[model samples]
Target chain A: MRQETSRAQAPIPAVAGIGLRFPHHRAVREDRPAIGWLEVHPENYLGGGAAIACLEAVRRDYPVSLHGVGLSLGSVDGLDPRHLDRLAALVSRIEPGLVSEHVSFSTAGGTYLADLLPLPMTEEALETVCRNVEVMQTRLRRQVLVENPSSYVRYVASTIPEWEFMAAVATRTGCGILCDVNNICVSAANHGFDAYHYLAALPAAAVGELHVAGHALRELGGGRQIRIDDHGSAVSAEVWALLAAAVARFGRRPTLVEWDNAIPALDVLLAEAAQADTILSRERDHAQAA
Target chain B: MPKLRDLQAGFAEVVLAGRFDALAPYLPADAIPPEDRLAIYRNTARAVMTEALRLTFPAVERLVGRDFFAMAAARFVRQAPPDTADLAEYGVALPDFLAHLPEAAPIPYLADVARFEWALHQAATAEDAPSLDADALGAVAAEDQPMITFIPHPSVRLLELATPADAVADAVLAGDDRAMAAIDLAAGPRRLVLHRGATGVCAEQCDADAFAFARALFAGATLAGLVDAAPAAAGTLLAGHLASGRIAGYALQTQTGEP
Candidate 1:
């Protein structure tokens, strides 16, 4: 039964949302947090059973967004329709505020790497991504958001810049951009590019959501730090500062506090989300004061 | 002149086949040393995928120890990278891979044990649907029984094994290593009916009649047809299936395509 009111709520209103992981399911169900929204990995609920049942309960109170890490959107072998179909089914089930996938490819030929593998920022890659996004949107019957991936390696054949590639995908496919501040920080440090330049190059209006996460910095051989976006710890001060800047510029977007590995207690995750909500509030105040 | 496909292929090779020497030249120097960066991916791919195998094949891991299991898991991941993103489905091929592995030849039963565990993992995630009522079968007349296909509950799985796979899994789950060690060839060829009840996935030794009824239902055999084609112990089979939730709901095959 459709709600008689045709006026539906907007995609999480530029506030701090937390990533709803498996461990936190019970807690989230018991105590509904006063957070902006929630994000979940679509692949986790592919077949549907208890986990899907849990998520169905969570969806009633919160605006849910689907973030896909395993779609392998940039794979050269073309998009996997089976995965797309499952994703479409999930989207239909939850009616998530937004659906997003990484710009990285996780598989090649027929095998899945299961990691967020980087893609060369070439014209061919861009065309493949755009076409895939178009197909995905058509199948889902909704606009999708494309996120930039953190990388430890870059391709020599890549002529286009990461920001340019992201902007082009959004522009060509009519998709939205899910700008991840941690990815920008990691990619910038890895590739020796300016993070701000990458952010500035983005088509601002196309960005529908933002992602903020923690990273692990490993000391390399020559005093260089290899920062991996592990998302295991609390949001670092540096990433938080960058997010503040983003909110100031983009006027606040639905942001996610993603901690996949070494997930902390539900209270800890909620605290982190509260901190992000504070930043969003500060930005809103600044806009109002202006 | 590398196309998108060429780059993707090379990237996969570097990660899966350890062909990093070819991809090293293509990586930028500002990042970590190409090989070290590649090692991050390799270690990650190994760890994430190995964890799935460990979950499905805990008995195998217990038999070989953690260190050996990790090494075997890395090898399995390299051979059979997951076809889907669902991590639960990633380790389905580990048993097959173990069966053919030169190192695993000595422990021939290891593969079958892993297969049994994987089936349990699959059953845990299978979709749940209401089972057909046995009383509903009485309504169907004898003439129309041929078209009657009894749909088994989604939770029920028919596993026929020549080895004591069920006993091994039961012992492992019960934390009885001695029971696993005491298994002898004399105790061979057992069948198990695995189903998800109100509590969780319950595994039990199904009698011949019960097994036949479940299989017949899975094959879309109706009650009337099942009675004619079933073994002489058909009554006992229906009783056992009904006692458990294995026959949750059933429908006419002509009415519904599959259970």
Candidate 2:
């Protein structure tokens, strides 16, 4: 058994950072880009190898955050113990600034679907998510933030709004909320809701981090389209505006510019981070004025 | 409204089996038909699994064209979806899956290439450990040398393949069609040992006797047993592995009643 105080935790700063992917591992390790921090999917570094060794080297210079893509926090079958153990071991090894997983479930009936499947906004789901979050926190011996997912379809059984369900998870579990601004934009456009209202509903105190990413618009003909959260291209104008709104509502947080597919060069990601910093700075100036 | 577990099961059915009826009742009515909306999630799930396989088995994808690879990957995903979140561990069954696939039978060497690639993937991602100290081995009493059992590095893998898949994989990865064409499909079984060192993953072919010796040593055979298994090259092979740092550590086997 490992003690909670065995490793010291690094706190993420309230500034823009980049999501570190495999392609840029060499560049980031050798060049050591002048960025605020770096976040990675803990799943990638769970198994030791060149990947973990590289992460160890990079962690020396930057405050790394483990953003998990497959914890399946909302699954009714319960969390996978092996996966949790691997993640806990990684946390002990990395001692990241922050650790997080999605509000959706990817495993069902003993099969991992590989995509973040949406959960019905029902009381049962709320309970399941809270229970899973508590389990994760207990195993990891630390607080974990749950990020809201982007969805194209809504369930008829959903009673509570998406934002309320998210806020409830934080309130019930004492965990933080990682507000993905682009997901808010994509889900709002797909479901015909106000993104600003979604942002305002989140508990200010529970908001610990923010994410902004690119999404694709898929047309269904006849002047109708669904915004897919593919994170393929540049952040759209609408998402940038929504991110600005989130910053204003949540204040400056450790925001990340996420680009998973069609990732560009290191300079391009840094440019996106710089763009987010501009909005974050404006919020700081506004707070000073207030 | 279905229970949360039932809802997830139904959603998974829709995503994995394309059975929209299971989830149709839960979806709210929309301008886009419910099935079409559900397809978005389905497509993303398939794409994610496909991409995971592509990352691990790029040579397999190159051996088969993109469209064919995608089709095969989709089939494999549906048949054997991953049970864990760590994708690095996914796709372990693909080589066997392809070996039995009728379409892939035309390319008889494809499965072997995939097996070799999986070995490469495992070697690259296996845990890191300290190599054996050469000086420590010399200090052991000469009498105990025969009882010394060598421990192989965590990343070492020994494979006896029926085809010359390594050369084909090399050619395919390099996109040298001429080199790929020159490979003799009739080449007999080849024995290989793969290990990761300070530089990167390395694979080498060895003679049958040496292969058996290394395999036994890795399987925890004492020096005496290793020599019994392959008397011709046990000493030379052990020395070579020690020099290459393949042996991580060693232990002496005590007498039966000794503590």
Query: How well is each residue in A1-290 modelled by candidate 2, as lDDT tens digits?
Result: 96554322378999999999999999999999888999999999887679999898888888899999988998999999999999999998898999999999999988998889999999999999999999999999999999999998899999999999999999999999999999999999999999999999999889999999999999999898999899898888898999889888888999999999999999999999999999999999999999
Please give, for residues B56-174, the per-residue lDDT of candidate 1 as tens digits: 77888876779978878878777778887778778877878888889878777778788788778777777767655667767877777556655567767778777787677677768
Candidate 2 regions with alpha-carbon error over 4 angstroms: A1-9, B139-141, B257-259
lDDT of 1 by residue, A121-170 (tens): 88988888888888888999888999988988888788998999999999
Off by over 4 Å in 1: A1-10, B105-108, B135-147, B177-185, B229-232, B247-259
Two-chain complex of model 1, DockQ on C-alpha atoms against the true structure:
0.63
State each model's CA lDDT, in order: 0.81, 0.92
Provide the lowest-lDDT 10-residue window in model 1 chain A.
A3-12
DockQ value for model 2: 0.82
True contacts kept of 1: 0.74
Q: Which ten residues in a row have the lowest lDDT in candidate 2 chain B?
A: B227-236
lDDT of model 1, residue B46:
70
